[model samples]
Target: MSTVTVTARGVTPDDVRAVARGTARVVVDDDARDAMATSRAIVDRIEADGRPVYGVSTGFGALANTQIAPERRSELQHALIRSHAAGVGAPMPREVVRAMLLLRVRSLALGRSGVRPEVAQSLVDLLNADITPWVPEHGSLGASGDLAPLAHCALVLMGEGWVRSPSGSRTDGGQALAAAGLKPLALAAKEGLALINGTDGMLGMLLLALHDAAHLFTMADVTTALAIEAMLGSDRPFQPELHAIRPHPGQALAAANVHRLLQGSAVMDSHRDDALHAVQDAYSMRCAAQVAGAARDTRDFAAQIAERELRAVVDNPVVLPDGRVESTGNFHGAPLGFAADFLAIAAAEVGAIAERRVDRLLDVTRSRGLPPFLSPDAGVNSGLMIAQYTAAGIVAENRRLASPASVDSLPTSGMQEDHVSMGWAAAVKLRRVLDNLTSILAVELLAGVRGLQLRAPLVPSPAGQAAIAAVGGTPGPDVYLAPAMEHARAVVTSPELRTQIENAVGPLS
Candidate 1:
């Protein structure tokens, strides 16, 4: 693994990706000490003047007007963390939790949020030392900036939540803090608000979703080519002229990618006019350029939003360089929340469309001369008949989860959080959509590869055949349908196949 010093201003999306993949580590920059000092002095000025700050000297949410005596302010901060640590659901994946830590660390390092140097360093120490909190997957509104989820993050700094050590699970934060030899941070000034009030959940979810979408967009194109050839469809629709007229970047790219994948192949070239007898291929094939293109466009747009959110200071009562502070809605999740919903919609469509193509591959009427249900002895052996059913089941679930959570908001926090973007729901559903798309595409990959093999000696383009060869040569004719589905799911989800294909063809742009 490589180590990278992460000053708030210097972190990039690539840096976050490296952290997510576990190929890199993060540390506060040497200059951050000065930033921390600036933060501390700012807090002093706020204290000297006795300013009323949101989530600082006052209470939170509906209780924002409630004041705490200075003597109890420190206790107030700790109590806030402990009280808001109310996440409930299955624990988030280790990668997601780690990404949250990284986001919090980056936000603090920006030096815009009014958190003390100790608070920022504690975040750094927790991440660098791997003292991550086991946060739950749900319980966030994506407004007031993922309050509950982030509070648990702050709790880990206080040494009270569940954490994993080399040995086993430990609920005692003190023991884990001592074992790691890390000290608890004194939440000076606006530290609690700085800790909990941010869009880290939405940010983390957006980054991971966008990253996966970019990879999967490439996979979708390649998989579609396999499906096209397997179905004996015409390649004319992929001609550059159609995409050139409309000139959508993602559409043109999809068309170009399909053409490249189909280059130098007997299956495609020999059957160049093969579908002349039919009016046009189904939407799955005919509209592949458009559907896949839309998804690609959305993914790119979402990536932009993720980059912006990652660099931003998302805390309330933002601390300035001179210790003057201001309350603001920087904690609102509207920005990334919208993108999260968009991402879920696109990903669900990706799966929804792939499911249609898989249906075409399995259907008795539409599947060319192949055996019904993809089995030679259709009556005796079910073959992939039920696999298609399972794919349908998954696609249905994706559709159900695809509803835009950002559009629907319910008030909480005594209506103070009215119009809360359910962006958290969007994140959760996008995750499900990603998983469903992988499975849906996997089933199609299996069926398409089988569809390709059944055509024997009529192999696809060099790129296509090479991909086939790389997927462990071709399986035997009697291979069980279950394993093929499993294999296809693995290939689509694994970055290896996607990366290899891109390497073979070079950059799209």
Candidate 2:
């Protein structure tokens, strides 16, 4: 029921999350309205003078040289929306649609897009009323402002497309608007181009993906702590004195978390002097900080890029305060594309390392004293043996998904828009990669928790105990593995593990 008053500045990732979840209403501030009015005057001047403005008076893209009379200008705007709303395949997730709407509104509210204040207000109204457009999954080239996907969203503004109700049921946009006590907006000069010409689609997904990544990175630390306890690995390698010599901030942070999580672990204490074991643990067990730390640093870099994008004005032919409308290449998505691709590479490596830990925990030879596959009777129960396989499968898939989509450019729009960024494709795949990483972490938690269970009377640290409790008790012989894995996945993906551990220990980095 609460609302977020959006200004020309100060929108954050958290704001996007709240609005996308339908828990917050958006209202434009007076300053943004004033700014928008200023831009609208410029557009009005261009319209009256019949100036050869890029989107205001002439056709778009390859047809830019063509001019139209004042009478058909309205038709030009309508035709532009109809033609560009060419997205196909399954409708995008409702949250993504909502985010697209919000970001588009934000971009226009920057007052550079030359739209009437009412046009932005209508989008805010649709969001407040919970009428989300049914945007499709494909059609953007990540250049020309996420054209096709955003066009689908703009279609609903004019009441010419479909939308989803608050209950997530599909309905006609016209019907939804009528029921919500609203009317369809008629497009004016430069409004159609204003709606579709931005990087909102790719940027919105990256914002959500970054939000999820923040939690996943913390979970990575929690699960890594559990893996170390289960493997009876030494924490000596994580010493602050050692990390200070070759300080990567992320590595040092990850090491500090491991040290804190294993502070008073009796399991680690029990093996501290066990000369029977090797002097050092395997790389997956000891080098978790190094690997996961590198991933964290890469994610931080991506977050920096997302923050910059949040502050940018992404439209083309932006209206200037000096009363000139000029075309520019701000619509190209190269920055977002590179960030998404780089983050995917980081996510894939984190999953790959976590899967290796799972394999080590389940292998009898590698696991030291644990029973084969961590099953009470290895022969009778497959006992998460195939869980490791599933993790491996997803990890391999992530490797393929991590192949940067941004590098593969194709020509479009009569080759007028060549060498596109493919940023939208990169962002879409990054989301999938993050999802796979969650599952991979869950698989590791499943086996790692069981390993700790077998460790028995020798208890883990408070943090490790919290993670073990979150994953629940180890399974008995020959039970259904899928449900247990799913439960573990739910625990791992949720904040339960982190909350319990943070409450027990001071807090994790």
Highest-scoring model, lDDT: 2
* Tens digit of per-residue lDDT, candidate 2, span 146-225: 99998888888898888876576778988888889989999998999999999999999999998888788778877787
Error of 1 at 56 (Å): 2.4
Deviation (Å) of 456 in candidate 2: 0.5
- Against the true structure, candidate 2 has what lDDT? 0.88
User: Candidate 1 on 387-432: residue-level lDDT in tens?
Assistant: 8888899988988887888888888888877878777778877877
Assess the local accuracy of residue 313 in candidate 1 as a C-alpha lDDT between 0 and 100.
81
Listed in order, each prediction's TM-score against the native is 0.94, 0.98
Candidate 1 off by > 4 Å: 165-170, 273-276, 470-480, 499-509
